[model samples]
Target chain A: AQSVTQPDIHITVSEGASLELRCNYSYGATPYLFWYVQSPGQGLQLLLKYFSGDTLVQGIKGFEAEFKRSQSSFNLRKPSVHWSDAAEYFCALNSGGGADGLTFGKGTHLIIQP
Target chain B: DTAVSQTPKYLVTQMGNDKSIKCEQNLGHDTMYWYKQDSKKFLKIMFSYNNKELIINETVPNRFSPKSPDKAHLNLHINSLELGDSAVYFCASSHRLDTQYFGPGTRLTVL
Candidate 1:
């Protein structure tokens, strides 16, 4: 079965520091990869997505993700983290057509320190 | 304007009660989905509808049913809700094989 894995359960980073959240996926074929963030008491927001385009994809809130095919990974990163960036980050993937639902990872809890 | 929206942002109900959560998307997308986030913050897909037709249904309980009256609307109805059903439910919509837009989500608490 296809699955998504977010290795870190919790990551603490000081504000203004660089950050990286690891993600790995298992699928039969090249899959559609995505990164989503959810703030406390909020819905999931799309951070970035990797389709058939360039390996590097940029998203809102100064977030970017790189999709590596050989490693089967799509990792999210930011140059300078902000206090507002603390939230639950999820990595997801879908292998089929548009009708197929996404398989999400357990998610990583990001804690921003001042 | 909200691209996708869900009604009853917070719902508190007793076990065995039946309730419904409505969702609508104005992005003109033909596909809508329901995802459940547990207390542990683990998210899972529950159902998917494409153009008012059921396309994907996970290993969800029979008490849970999804109704898509039209392409722009999808509603989830839960019968005999249990305490284990307490979780946040999100509604999302997407065009064919494209990025999906998510709603604000509905938090359901069954006591």
Candidate 2:
């Protein structure tokens, strides 16, 4: 079965520091990858997605993700993290179309230090 | 303007009682889905409807039923709620084979 894994359960970083959240997926074919961020008591917002072209995809809120096919990984990165960046991040995978449901990771909690 | 929205942001009910959560999307998408996020923040897809037809049901209990009156609306009804059923339920909509848009989510608590 297709699945997503986020190895780091919690990550603490200082403000203005660089950030990287790891995500790895298992699927038969080249998978459609997505990264979503959820703030406290808020719905998930799409940070970035990787489909076909360009291994590097940029998303809203100054976030970027690189899709590595051989490694079966899509890691989210952000430079100069802000205190408001403290939130939970989830990595999800889809098999291609809307017909298939997305397989989500357990999520990683990001803590921004002052 | 909310692209996808769910009613009753917070619901507290008894174990044996029944409750309903409504969802609507203004994006004119053909597909809608329900996902449950547990206390550990692990999200899993529960049900999906396409064009007002049930397309996917992921091992969900019979007590949980999803109804889609139209392409833009999907509702989830639970009969005999259980303590284990307490979780955050999110509603999402997407155009055919496109990125999905998620709602604010409804937190259901069974007492």
Candidate 3:
């Protein structure tokens, strides 16, 4: 079974500062990876996904993630985070089909400090 | 228009009561899924339907049943709900083996 691990439970970053959220996965083969964001009371919004071809996948809201095969990691990064970027971020992984669905991490709570 | 939507954004009920949460997707996708988010915000897949067929069913309690009327709608019904059943249920849709789009979620609170 494929599982995702997001080590950081909560991270606080000052506004306009660069941010990086670490995510690692355990899978037998090459996997599909994704990053999702959730607001205070809303549903999840897909930040980005890595299907194939590109090692670096760009997602919505100026977010990007690099898929490292050796590291088994797909860490989300942003050069400068705004105040609006404060939310819960989840890292997910899927081996193949959507039937089994994607396994998500415990989620990382992002706090934007002024 | 909402791409993927679920009914009763919040559901509050007591133990032993029965409730149903409806989900509909207008994205013309071929698959739909149900996921549960616990109080601690840990998410797990409950069930999945593809083209009106059960494609995935997790080790959930028998009280939870998923009914797919068509490819565009999947409804989740819980029988004799318990306290442990309380959580936020999310509905998602996706193309065949593609990125799944999620709904706003239904916060089912059992008191």
Candidate 4:
């Protein structure tokens, strides 16, 4: 079964500091990867996605992720995170096909210290 | 205009009762999905419909039925709701297997 692992349950970073959220997936073949952010009491917003394209993919709110096939990882990174960036970050994978649903990680709670 | 929306942002119901959550998307997407977010914030896909046709039912219980009235609307009906059913439900839509846009979510609390 395809699964996602987000090692960090929670991460704390100072405002305006760089941020990186780790994500690893277990799948038989290369799958579609995505990053989503959910603010408190709100729905999730797609930050970015990786299909068949350049390894490094950029997303909204200055977020970016790199799909390293060899590493089986799709880590989200931000040059500088604002306080508004503090939210739950989830890494998801879809193994193609219309019947397949996105397998999401446990999610990492980002806390931006002001 | 909201791209995707779910009715009744909050719902409180008693166990064994029946309830429904409605979802609609104006993005003209062909696929609609239902996801459950537990208390731990673990999100899982319960069902997916493509063009009003059920395509994915991820071993969800029969008590939880998803009805896609049309290509733009998908509703989830829960029967005999249990305490464990208390969580946030999200509706999402996309163009086939493309990026999905999500609704604000409905928080269901079964007491």
All candidates: CA RMSD (Å): 0.9, 0.8, 0.7, 0.9
Off by over 4 Å in 1: none
lDDT measured at residue A101 in model 1 versus the true structure, 0 to 100: 85
TM-score for each of the candidates:
0.98, 0.98, 0.99, 0.98
Question: What does the lDDT read for residue B20 in candidate 2?
Answer: 100
Residue-level lDDT for B33 in candidate 4: 94
Compared with the true structure, model 2 gives a TM-score of: 0.98
Candidate 3 structure quality by residue, lDDT tens digits, B19-81? 999999999999999999999999999999988999888999999999999999999999999
lDDT of each: 0.94, 0.93, 0.94, 0.94
Residue by residue across A1-114, what tens digits does model 3's lDDT show?
789999999999999999999999999988888999999889999999998898999989999999999999999999999999999999998788546688999999999999
Worst 10 residues of 2 chain B by lDDT: B92-101
Give the clash count for model 4.
Answer: 0
**Can you tell me the CAPRI class of model 4?**
high
Residue-level lDDT for B42 in candidate 4: 100
Interface RMSD of each: 1.1, 1.1, 1.1, 1.0
**Model 3 chain A: ten consecutive residues of lowest lDDT:** A93-102
> lDDT tens digits, residues B33-65, model 1?
999999999989999999788998999999999
- For candidate 4, the C-alpha RMSD (Å) to the true structure equals 0.9
Residue lDDT tens for model 2, B1-111: 989999999999999999999999999999999999999999999998988888889999999999998999999999999999999999999887678899999999999
- What is candidate 1's lDDT per residue for A1-114, written digit by digit as tens? 999999999999999999999999999899999999999998888999998889999999999999999999999999999999999999999886658988999999999999
